[model samples]
Target: MSRIADIAAALAGYDPKALSVDGVQAFLAELVAPAILRERERVPLFEALGRVLAEDVVSPFNVPPHDNSAMDGFAFDGAVLDTPSSGFVSLRVAGTAFAGTARHGALTRGDALKIMTGAVMPAGFDTVVPQEFCTVDGDTVRFPANALRPGDNRRFAGEDLRQGLPALLQGERLTPAGLGLLASLGQAEAPVLRRLRVAYFSTGDEILSLGEPPREGAVYDSNRYTVFGLLTRLGCQVVDLGMVRDDPAALADALTDAAERADAIITSGGVSVGEADHTRAVMKQLGDMAFWRVAMRPGRPMAVGLIPRSSAGDAHEGAAVLFGLPGNPVAVMVTFLAFVRPALLRLMGCNAANAAPPPMLRARSVAPIRKKPGRTEYQRGRVTCLPGALPEVRIAGNQGSGVLSSMVEGNGLVVLHHAQGSVAPGDEVDVMMFDGVV
Candidate 1:
């Protein structure tokens, strides 16, 4: 808790009054320390999907283990290709070799062994000419010298992975392909960082829960479901705390309960001004919180801090980080995408390189957009390729904070950065794609 203050004070221009988008990122980067060092668990390959690899997966043996054929062809000494006097290379068809069995005699210099894909290359054979390219007459097979090169269609031992080299590096997020790679290395299980626990809830008396009847001026809570999906997609053990009203004691109790059980807490609503909410006051009493009116549109009202671990004394790992986001649907999403998600990844044991901002796509605006300088704005946009031209983008319906439909309609968010002016029809802009995020 004390270190967080020291960290913020150490920043060159630390200003909670008017923090920039980049400022929020920098603060989080400085504050977050990966939870990977705390502990790791060994999980079977089947259960390791999406888990962060805690250690490098060193290959136990060469991937192929032996030189093998990559195609169904005839394997012969590569030197024979250059030794041919005629324009064609010729060899005696010795014997056939099939996949999964390497039961062929060593081939002589002029002898070619019929081999199937994955068949071990017979001794003295280093090249293969696909059967489709060779003409067989009696026992001899003939092919053009230029038809194949030396070592063609041959998979060398250790070609895919060397025995001593790391097959998968530490901090890698295991995917289906990674699972297959591990299987190739004959690994049955993997060492991975333990899953992160995150608890989230919505705040505001006007926000109604599902199954509740609608009332005038009160909207159903969409932030909980959206946040839940986002957290689940992030591979965290999400603790759904439902929705908390604007009451002070209830908000405090909810935050306290979440902090005790989870690594982080996410709360939407009550961060905005002119609202009779106790979110700020409750945070001040229970945690070391910093409220910020960030220099960003839709999601400008945000808070970040740490809640002390009241349940655990010496056994406690550390304090839980807090993310106080806006109440609006789009704002909550934008803030989460722009800030909370990256911080959570860092906390989830992702290395610095892996936790970097998600890459954005460059696209040309399809129309003029009005904008002012000094603050960043995220606009929902639909991007499409124009065949010959660069990818172009247009606004996606109404860009309202409450408009979740626009987020659905848009494939991405056109990122208008701080200090940037209005955009013209042909202006190029950076867009954060929602392909996997949404």
Candidate 2:
């Protein structure tokens, strides 16, 4: 074993089955620090959705560029209503103005213009009376006393934005609303962080391809699809390398190809200490591998490494990071969210996207909860919010990572503390909602 490997092994303790999930998460984060982002690119506004921003976006012009009206009414001064029983003064309608028009004319005393909502408020007119409140007869509008305020109906120019302001900071992922903001500022193209090229694969002979006959004790591969969806959601350019058997040579070749073509390589299964697990052996031959047993349940064994491939004939030179998740579906999903997602975001140059939000929701446990001490458990659960009350969460049908139905039926992940052994019915706990489901 290499010196780094030995140190890692000593620091991480033994027994893959005994590694806590928290330990594994911290180890993974430390192992994959400083993942450099790819190159930058200028893409159209339509194509920039979901892409990370390469540079700060500044507004060339202020929003609303000019002062506008907030309501459809007669534009006049509010001080004219200081006297009581003013007895309906009729102001001459000088002209009409609408939104997006330049107001070159100014209002005079006893002269009001019919202004529409969003219309540029003419200089000298500080208030607007809703057209519904006053009757317009020919060129005169009858204004009631105290019908308007000095600034009640005016929307000042640049109130929404200022000229040349830093509207968006660098490392912001473009969302639909973000794109709308860009469009409003007349930005047709955007400078965005280049898409991350991620390579993925699944191991184990028991994992069959879609539409393939399932052999006894074998299950169809779903991790690839799930990871693909998750990566897509994260705006990654995924390259599916398909499934490989538990052969050391085949695994090495796949890793080599992935390192050359992708910035990061993600694989499921085959890193455990079992005899059929050749992923660790292949990684050791290729690069620096660190296997850690975390303190979290559902996910325990995970592998992180910086692959150092030799520049021999047909081999790649630069290092490509590796994340070896567990074969179990739930374990793989949880591990990816807790560990892989942060690294991926850093590699994509998104600063805030990697931050994990707290799952501190109030939930009442409907059934008895059983968990061992010293391991944090993310119990798949279904949560329902009672109107005007806290949400209630119950464990899904089963807690096994291999049970796909459990995740499908779950609305959230009920987080049980590492020291909490078990809880009886009606105990309140914290749950993280999935897809915003309560």
Candidate 3:
């Protein structure tokens, strides 16, 4: 078999989906088990948010070490309670207890203590009376005899958490709210998975760095930034290797540097049999590589492999995994979402067995769409919804992979099936909304 044909067969072992994105996602799950390979590190609570937990976290103690007042009120023994219709009763103010300060005094008959929210209620004081309904002056306070029920205005100890209970499970990503919960439990540090280190860059001389003037036939490099932002959103530490020329020497040097430090290296373009493409040749010299003619549109010639390091000695046995994406801007995007994202996630230790994007939503297309019935297509779209109507999505002006303008202005990708042809107006289509774009 030809080199390209052999590579194609090797990639086919990954089981690309004919038209279903789900099938592609399933294939990725098998290839990238993000939850398996990464190690955990302890981080300050302030820096723990968005980091996945390395293992189940157990609380050192109960959330509330003791029963406390849930509101600003009075703490007294509940034995004084009688009928609901009883009139006001007077009591002597024993002392004041505030949140975060323990109560030093206890309650006795005809005695009440002023308590604030979260204040530890004194022992034998099982109920609280709000100052609103009660009158307080000097050391004396009075409340309606029926103001509170048993255990009113009180938060029982361990109600929020029990001692040694699992506060959080492994593989759960921490959030601001989760951090606060940990704070309430008195945890200052968290055991979290270490950030996954990834190296990626744009390929081809036709791609220019942003802020540089574009010459004829040249476009500013956008995929590197796009993928970089996405990886940051996933909390991965990324090393931007910059743009690589389509020459074997330059490509080999860049790949070598990236393989030395990164868990994986990803590049866009020059993986196909294009005349100027040298990525495949370099991959051959460095490590095993495979090109996949995946049965999908927007991205067809996708490549995956490892770049071997011959000089790293026997310590470096396996090579750094690589992804060579297509040159088209949109194709780079679709292929990355379908393949690379999951693998990166797995490497990050997030239990990211796969990188399946959120489920697609069914929406009505506002205009007609043209396409053949072979490769699946991801068309850029703009979406808007009226208050009482379902969201209506319209295709962007261009479908060409090089048109970065459409991607900049669009909010979602409207997917067309392999068996499905041109879509008429008002036709229902599956649209993947770009939520959480970094």
Candidate 4:
């Protein structure tokens, strides 16, 4: 097991006192290892939404399985089209082929089969002319000679997916379309990894749970609820530890209990240098902890560590990682999106692409923003896109860290990166959208 000091010492220009946002990310990349996997969980197709596949999903057989008609049309040999001297080519109607039915024998050069969409093509037929394009008589069908080329409107076997090839990869998350693809392959169920178990709670005496009477200098605990929603939306199996007071012993007990049962632990509050903050002390006692003052707005203070599941209370490699977030409403979410989310995805065994942060999009600023160099800032914003114009963005609400309303009205975060100065109205800025994620 690599000690926390060793990991910090390995990074170039490492500074735990004042870490950059990118520096924090790089450290976490080395800190979090993939969770130990158990046997693959076999789940019915209908019930496997957002689950990661335990192994490659291979196709059992070719999709379509055979050549078929792409539409309601007449199937015939395309060779006759070239031999005809007339401007239009005609063929005698032989028989009808409906979907789910098969026909035998070949269609002679001058003969055509009236075939519906998805009907298996009979022997010796390679083209199909849509019914609307052809003029049909009682026993003959006619169409322009150049209406389509040879092999037109005919779907070849294995076109969608071939047999013995991987249709979906391991660690790939299943969405609605993925489930449909499985159904198309005639799979009744899918094999997926077990759900990731995440434990979360809010810490601080000033924080109150729901139904508790409000008192002076105390506020209702909103962080826990927001944390709950975020974890569940990510399809994690969430363990809500509720709100713990400022006492050191209670905090330690809650964290120890959570670590034993969950793959990761998240807590909001008691990470700063406030008098009541004992999270750092307890974390260092139970695990190898690094309390960092990150160079980022709203979420500058955080604690990262690894906690052992055994009763010995000593943290080692490959155990549960802890993320102690700031108490501010907005900070908790910001740190989660910027840091914790990516780490969790990695622990979930997701591939690089899926585990990366949501892409940042370019947007023209609607107004100037005052920002200094040396730290990153995330401002809540609403984007307006007009036809034939680049999308424009403006600040949404109060940018206070403790005020959570800012995150609610906005659809994205206007990312003013480190080393960037004041933004002008027309300057292009980056925005991390919250369309489906928030």
C-alpha lDDT score of every prediction, in listed order: 0.88, 0.79, 0.76, 0.87
Which TM-score value belongs to model 3?
0.76
lDDT score for candidate 4 against the true structure: 0.87
| Candidate 3 residue spans exceeding 4 A from truth | 1-20, 34-36, 74-82, 86-95, 104-113, 124-153, 210-213, 295-297, 310-317, 352-399, 411-437
Higher-scoring candidate on TM-score, 2 or 4: 4
- C-alpha RMSD of candidate 1: 2.0
Candidate 3 global CA lDDT score: 0.76
TM-score of each: 0.95, 0.86, 0.76, 0.92
Error of 2 at 266 (Å): 1.0
lDDT score for candidate 1 against the true structure = 0.88
Model 2 root-mean-square deviation: 4.0
Off by over 4 Å in 4: 34-39, 80-86, 311-318
What's model 1's lDDT at 46? Answer: 89
Candidate whose TM-score is highest: 1
Give the alpha carbon lDDT tens digit for every residue of 38-143 in model 3. Answer: 4668999989978888888898898888899988888888777763344767778988898988767446867899899999888888998888988878899888
